[model samples]
Target: MIFPEGGGRESHRKEEIKQYYRSFLWSLVFTVPVFLIAMIFMYIPGIKHALDTKLVNMLSIGAILRWVLSTPVQFIVGRRFYTGSYKALRHGSANMDVLIALGTNAAYFYSVYSVLRAASSTDFESTDFFETSSMLISFILLGKYLEVLAKGKTSDAIAKLMNLTPGTAILLTLDDEGNVISEEEIDSRLIQRNDVIKIVPGAKAASDGFVIWGQSHVNESMITGEARPVAKRKGDTVIGGTVNENGVLHIKATRVGSESALSQIVRLVESAQMAKAPVQKFADRISKYFVPLVIILSISTWLAWFLAGKFHGYPDSWIPKSMDSFQLALQFGISVMVIACPCALGLATPTAVMVGTGVGASQGILIKGGQALESAHKVNCLVFDKTGTLTIGKPVVVNTRLLKNMVLRDFYELIAAAEVNSEHPLAKAIVEYAKKFREDEENPMWPEAQDFQSITGHGVKAIVRNKEVIVGNKSLMLEHNIPISIDAEEMLAETEGMAQTGILVSIDREVTGVLAISDPLKPGAHEVISILKSMKVRSIMVTGDNSGTANSIAKEVGIETVIAEAKPEQKAEKVKELQAAGYIVAMVGDGINDSPALVAADVGMAIGAGTDIAIEAADIVLMKSNLEDVITAIDLSRKTFSRIRLNYIWALGYNLLGIPIAGGVLFPGTGFRLPPWIAGAAMAASSVSVVVCSLLLKNYRRPKMLEHLDIGGIKIE
Candidate 1:
């Protein structure tokens, strides 16, 4: 539900992290003293001479002290690995836990046997390895602690998202006429639909609803990534978690609890985080058999070394005179098992996905799922929906001419009344423009429209104030057999030439006036197309507008291809056609009609201001609603996948080299070998390096295309 106050499960995870830290500290405490009392410290040149003398008996004192210190570290601090290993074994699987348990226990049991022999006989040869077992456990614990810390940083975006909502709300008590009488603060969870809430200056909204009274500027940067605060008035919708900058507002809750926008965003981000990227699936497939394979290799290494040591007369001269073939074989096997870590392979992708998703959320780019990020990187062709996408959705009244016997105000009222119920961007613009010129003292009201119907890709039809009113394009007029006058045709041609959509308003089958509406190109639309050209990506404009207007708009934006008179289904067909032509297509749109096309594209990119249906169908949501973010989404995906590839190479290469070395491959030729402690250190380093590399993605920034260029005479001011 995107609760800002973390629930019980999150608290439990925090406790688990604390437990790991405590166990690591205890292991370090005992491991330090055990190392000081064993051969590791005794082998130091100065210490070796002193220990051999009467001051301390190397065998008796060191063996007893190391055994006493190592026991608790092995059993208490390293207990989880044993339990985890047992669980994995019962399930017929092998994992990092199995390696840790096998390597540490082998050295520990052998040391235990040696200590028992030393206590029984004075002639017992010293073979205690308490330091090796203790140090291995300590190192494994340290690695886990670092892993836990790194994983925490990767999820900071989720934490920040949850922090945006306030815990409490000020519920207002209203009188009979819906005027506020009093208010009481209560838990935000208690808020319900239809409840009235009071929001003051500097207070965040408690839920998603409509403001019924008062006015304010709301800062919605957290949700939309827009730096400017949007002004909110009565009847304006306000989203939860946005700050009210001035004045007070009485809002009627339309959506509360899990239905709020913040909750949906959290759900989308969490689902994306949980889903695996395509590259990650390959790594997972490899890891399913990686551990069991490593175990078999370790066994084979031991057998080979043991057979070689006996038949080939022990390759290395550094082995102690007291050690036999069996001891050397066991040591080599333990080193091989410890050095071949599957942890590095398993961690390679999830860490990168987590960091990438987190970074995306922070920038207001919500990747719907990891699969989208994987696919977005390969998009080579982009198809853009014209209205409310490449251009501003708000259509302004550029030029108006009245024809038949009617006042200008009456013509506007008839047109606005027919379009009042529609949710279209052009309809909204006309309604808003009409409201400003309304002469009524009270709230603006238009006569009711009867038999209303909205024609998809055309316009609206209705009977306003018992008079037939049709407001739409030339197609709607032609379909109804309403002939346009010579003067009207000339006006329409001039309007189309000027890149304006002419809304032809008629009354009772006769033309009344022509309202020239122009939805202007969005700032930076041209620059975005220019950048895509430089990037070698093809751009196409698909719209329901007439060819002349469509072509004019496309030319201004630098889009080379234009497909005019396209319905929603035709738009999807265009995307499919592009894919069939061997192009990886990306569809950018921002309306309900765009949902089908969005889903049809290889990568569906929905602008943040788009309808909920469009956003749901889209794989990637650009919160800025800026065309430039299309480039950002693609670039970010490419960079993230690049990092994943590098991680795979590093993990595979580390295992390829280390496993063979730890198996004693060089011993036959060079007589050199990696010790057990050194092998453990290398395994830890491999896992940590993969995680650190993924973390480096947090420093990513968008390309500086606009900052470096001086376009014509206009410097970026």
Candidate 2:
């Protein structure tokens, strides 16, 4: 029932056919005893003697009764194969169902006619009446039942995903001072944009919306592939199907129905299922030739046996056994068809991808699809954006250099007062530093800043306490006709050598002191680079900052390659350059400027808590902003692809060894033949093996760095 009348109609049809086969299995159970009774009348000597002595004239009546009961059983329970074979033959193609329907019905009608003709003959035996038809029908039904169960296991992932969408929604109406009012309860479709929907604790959200008020943690694992619940506040987006951990939220719907992120995720997953893997193409090519070859060989086998009987000096007495030879050939051909099913070949790649994606979700790494997961394993080079990807993107005061005959605290106060109205990150750093060093009497009672002006890429100027205060770079000082003294130049050179942004402070047209500000590297950034080195991934940094600052941070993180002073378009070009050099590059960043580069890379991994543009452009978005997930994602892809290969080998290898044995290749010289029941059982065993192989992938162990390294030489302190 997981498949219904919709876009996935083919999947639904396949399930319906499987269920029909299961019903035939139940019919086979009921008909076994009837088959045994017919066999007893023909083979047992006592029963045959009694039938010949007392009811010899009634044999025609008995044959008619057998025909009446068994015809419905064959046509009704076995009608599925008959219809399928008819369709295949009409299209000039033959498959396993064609062989089963033709072989079994031929054996049945042959026995029926033989029994009826023998009623007039004086010397007649019913041995041929009971042997062929019952065996073929029983075996084919068994094979079909097992095939259904295995195919069900292969498609479990899609069924589980469909179960995520909730069946109902709660529509909010109105709230009085101390009372609640309820409107008419309606379906999810009636909910419109900007409508307030009340989500109870532990219930799945019905639509994509933003929280108007209240707080809770929502589990967005099904949509974003993250297992942990993310905390939501007012103005934060919530996706449908995610569970609310606690607290009620009055959410205003942003996207309803198919436009929601949850719906897009479901659509993506379903599309992945429809894609055929490379191994299935091989099976399709092989099947194109397999059916015709089997049919020709079966005809040749019958002709060879019939001609040999004629050449051996046997007369009309050899006619019965010659007919038996043709029946045997038909039986072998049917067995070959049933045992060579393509279930494993089709399931190999998709099952591994489904499980791999699920495992990645638990670790907070979101992979878009099978292609992305496959390509991630082969990435050789990693390029990074500098502002938010490498550095923390927050400028801070790193050092304070006092000029000759200048006080450090006074220098900080003047700079802070001059930048009081500035909004740049650099300005905030100076103000925060002044606040940290503030003293009761040391606080400057400067007049309110006036005519504040900011020079792009330089600094700010303001009139403080009626004195012109300049806090800017060297260029800003020269533009204002303020001369930098010998002491100020010496201090600026020292700050530049330390890879710091030098902010010159001048009061009343004279240089006072220098303030150095720079964006600090993120914590554990160096360790992340070292880990990438251990994994053999080449790391490079690209930035819009000056060459000195770029190289300074790159050296701290142990990265040797740096692209300095790059604009947004230039950063994307650098990614293309790395890719042109035969490297599968991955760009990691967290800013609007990095969007183009993120889209151009082989794998775009966005650090969480970044700009919305960067996150949208990335293929795999890291929810925790931890660099370690890059290694985790690559390791996951490698393991997943390895499993897919193993499954394909096992599935194809089993059919290669099975089809020949089912064709009676060992029959002529050694008088050996594969019984139909054994062929049915072997087919079931092969299907079970494929399912078990897929399930074993759930136990794959993700590689950990600590397990393979010695950290004793690296001091943790």
Candidate 3:
């Protein structure tokens, strides 16, 4: 298991990765000479003659050389395994550390016994296996070094996000009127909320806040995945870490430090990696008892082999002629212990999860945890909220027609004044549309409206320039007893039939004009829906809008299933109904009302939540709100889970097949035997292969959804 002890900071993890690599280097330095003396020099005729000659008074030169070389590797470089194994055993558990310490220590102690016997009797045949113990420690340390390196690559996304924040910021000293009077450069960590800062051209914003002084194009592609730099002006909110590309901007810090966008994203990704998935829990359970059970099997195999060797009188030549029954039994036991260690089983899930979550973060898809990544692969039904999810959330005035003989300037000024104070989307569209008409005038101003009242879901009414002005839909106009002529009514009906919102402007109880407003569908929305359909995913649109408007928008986007006029709670109920019918549902939405349905679905996907990294109910957040990311997310999850399955098969197969062979299963039939050094090499190779397999996910690319056309300047073909 990977331990994130320093709260997921990249520097802390780098230190840990380096520490393992350093330890591995030291182990190899000592183990190589020990290996040559114990395995190579003893087999060479000339070198064996020199080593067999007495160099010292009591000990042979070979015995003294092997002891000096192997002692440091067992006690110094291999000390962590002993301490880790002891701690785990004290807590009534056994892990990979326990298996390593047991296997290597057993081999080391047996070699020490052989060295002592050789010193006592000059003719005692030396059977020192110090090479087995030293090589086992060296191989395991090498596997650990590579594992640490692979794990670090999985957190590269978080590191890149932290690097986006500037080290220093230009803090501004403002006058009483909030105008900048002076500026000083200070560390970014010293910044607080409400502190005004200057962001010059090509500099990153210090914190999340609104632009207070200048205007510029800010590149938010790091968080939103949009390639274009967004236009930022005074009063426009800018996220911290976004760059001011072309203009100098003065911004006040609204959210600093932990509340910044970059900080939240890093925190969320770290938490996602640390949380265990359901399958991960199952793997943990199996590994918890896996080591101890392997120990028992190793002991059982040793006893069975020893009893068979004694009764059969060494009839099989599988046992070496020079070795006794006990030495042969010890060899098989050491092999079994080294081969059955559960390092690969421990690595099967987390390495894959870390790499998968990191890949999702780079694409602006924030998955909350491994459980979400696991569950996302099985989603077959997708439910989408209509307003901000399928169509552009902002409404625009499409066309306006005059219904009364009134001054055009006067009509625009009155409507703009009445609706300017309204916060509704349609009202804001109208206020923005009227501003363009006044560009020719030198100083065109809107008269302040009095006694203003906004009718929710209807429109606004106010007294503008001593005239009673009311701007609303047909229902609001009829509620106030305003008479509409046949021509105006026909115009309103025509716009509504085309899935547009009709706003009626009435001055002094007389209908003056009808404004056609519509929330247009987003670009490439139709193509994305078609792509999902071709991928065999069922798409459904759920909204509180009228059936006519909802169906009209759905039909244009190739969505056949429409749940129109459904309230927030009703949307969640619809999701539950689908889930009960044996379909895995993925709900996608952006508004607060969609939170309930987002939580009710199998996987809740929040769209366009660029700076809001902590979307409460969403399992996955698509920062750009692009429909293309929805397909990318599903494709990535499927591929990631598929990689995980392959890893499990390899890990389980390696242990099952390796343990028996190391226990001398083929000796009786094929006259073949496994060696302790070979067993250690196989164990190390198995763990390294599992980590290498997970690293392959870093190269995963989202499948091309629209291969025939260009979307966002990326040609899929």
TM-score for each predicted model, relative to the true structure: 0.90, 0.68, 0.86
lDDT of each: 0.83, 0.68, 0.83
lDDT, candidate 1, equals 0.83
**Model 2 Cα lDDT, one tens digit per residue, 283-338:** 56665666566556555544554455556523444334424444455556555655
For candidate 3, the 10 contiguous residues with the lowest summed lDDT are 1-10
lDDT by residue (tens digit), candidate 1, 1-717: 446434443575577789889998998899888877565667688766554443223356666777889999888889999899899899887789998888888888988887676666656665766788888888877777787778777877777777788889999999999877889999988999999999999999999999899998999988876667889999999999999999899999999888898888877787787789888878878877888888888888888878877786665574546466667777788889998878888888888888888788877789977799898889899999998889987778878888877777778888888999898888888887887668563467888999999987778999998889988888889999998998888888888899998788889888888888899888888998998888889999998777778888999999989998787898999999999999999999998878889999999999888798999899999987877778878888888889888988999999899988988788767867776777887888888888999999999787778554343344432
Better of 2 and 3 by lDDT: 3
Off by over 4 Å in 2: 1-18, 29-31, 34-74, 82-189, 198-204, 219-229, 246-248, 297-323, 351-370, 377-626, 668-671, 704-717
Shift of residue 649 alpha carbon in model 1, Å: 2.2
Task: Compute the lDDT of residue 620 as modeled in candidate 2.
Answer: 74
Clashes within 3 Å, all models in order = 0, 0, 0
Considering TM-score, where higher is better, how would the candidates rank from best to worst? 1, 3, 2
For candidate 3, the TM-score is 0.86
Q: How far in Å is the alpha carbon of 496 misplaced in model 2?
A: 9.6
